[model samples]
Target: MEHKIQPLLNYISKYIVLSKKDEAVLMSKLIYRKYLKGQYIAQQGDVCKYECFVISGCTKMFFADEEGQEHIVMFSIEDWWTADMGSFITQTPADYNVQCIENTELVLFSYDVIEELYTEIPQLERFFRKIIEKAFVASQKRIVRSFSLSAKDRYLYFRNQYPKIEQRIPQYMIASYLGITKEFLSKIKGQLIIDQ
Candidate 1:
């Protein structure tokens, strides 16, 4: 069980050093979970119960508008964290849904547990703060890019960030993430092939 926690500890260590005692405090609070593909980890209008750190596989965080179309907010894979930040922080209803894109293994800490961990391990709080800061920065950049760049450019940026992800997921999911139609995505890929 402790061995299973090493990857998460190593990830946290990249942000802030964790004493073995601090690690134990954190490890005690963690609950490991596995989700099959197509399962919902968090749903809109419900409080996000846990802060999730991905150990393996992929998940999609998205918003489903009134028309019932899903606009992907982001993707999380190995070594990534996925949660509705506002919901997790405030214990309020989530605006986005987090769903498994592949069979996923995650290390989870509930909202109450996070508060407990913070008091027990100050470095844990600092590590989370850093993660939140990066997530916010990335969100802002994605918003700016959506306004400034064409769909093709956005797809290119995503490809650069997750080169092998395309082969793993459906083209339509990637298209939805880029705010484009699947047919339009096909056309864009065709154009890229010709350009190359």
Candidate 2:
């Protein structure tokens, strides 16, 4: 359990310096857990109480439309942090679901605990602020790409961005993330191969 936190500590150190006491406090608050593939870490309509840091494996954050179609919002892997931000901060129900795509290990922090940490270690607040800023920027870019790029172009971009992930998950999930049909993604991939 102590060793499991090294990845998270290393990630945080890249952004902010932590004193030994701060590191101890942070580690004490972390709850380590495991989830099997297809298990939900969070679900729509539930209050998102924990902000999770992935130690291993993959998870997807998604939401279903009224028509019951799931739209992939984001994918999180090793060293990535994930939570339904609005719900986690506001203490309200989540509009999205986060589920493991493979057996996963995570270090989780509850909302109150994180708030306490922020007060105890001001640097942690700065670190999380930077994390959210990057997340926002990536969200904006994704929105722009959806409007400006063709499906095939978007697929190519996604492949470039997450090459390892592309090989790990099902193609249908990738198509959903790209906002395209599985058949369409298959066709695009086939055409790209032929063109090459």
Candidate 3:
């Protein structure tokens, strides 16, 4: 698992350099876990216990509507982080559900463990701030695109941003993320093919 965790160390290094001591402390608290496809990592009403970094595989963060429709907010794949920020920070029930899109391996930090890490390694605070900033920025961009872009354009943006993820996620899931119907997504794809 150390080898698997090396990627996380590498990722964090890109943001803030960690000393051997700091690295050891951070790694010591991380929990390695795996979930098979169709497993739920976090449910709508359960407090999120872990802040997970994807070592490999994919997951979706979605919410159920009054009609029981699932609207995907985002998908996290290899090297990405997935957690309900509100739930994790506030220690409250999550509004979204995070489910594995495929068999997934993750390195997780519990809420308590992360707090300790922050105290032990102050630079880790900066690293996490950057992570949250990126997530927040991406979220804002997604919100803007939703109102301004056509469904076809949104699909194209999604494809360009997540080419690998596009292949793994089902059409219906992708449609939900783009706020379109599955049938409509099919039409958009067919039209794209014609244009190409």
Model 1 ranges off by over 4 Å: none
lDDT, each prediction:
0.91, 0.93, 0.93
Candidate 2 per-residue lDDT, tens place, 98-190, comes to: 999999999998999989999999999999999999989999999999999999999999999989899889999999999999999999999
| Cα-lDDT of candidate 2 | 0.93
For each predicted model, how many residue pairs clash, with residues at least 3 apart or on different chains? 0, 0, 0
Tell me the TM-score of each prediction against the true structure. 0.97, 0.98, 0.98
lDDT of 2 at 51: 94
TM-score, cand. 3? 0.98
Which is the better candidate, 1 or 2, if ranked by lDDT? 2
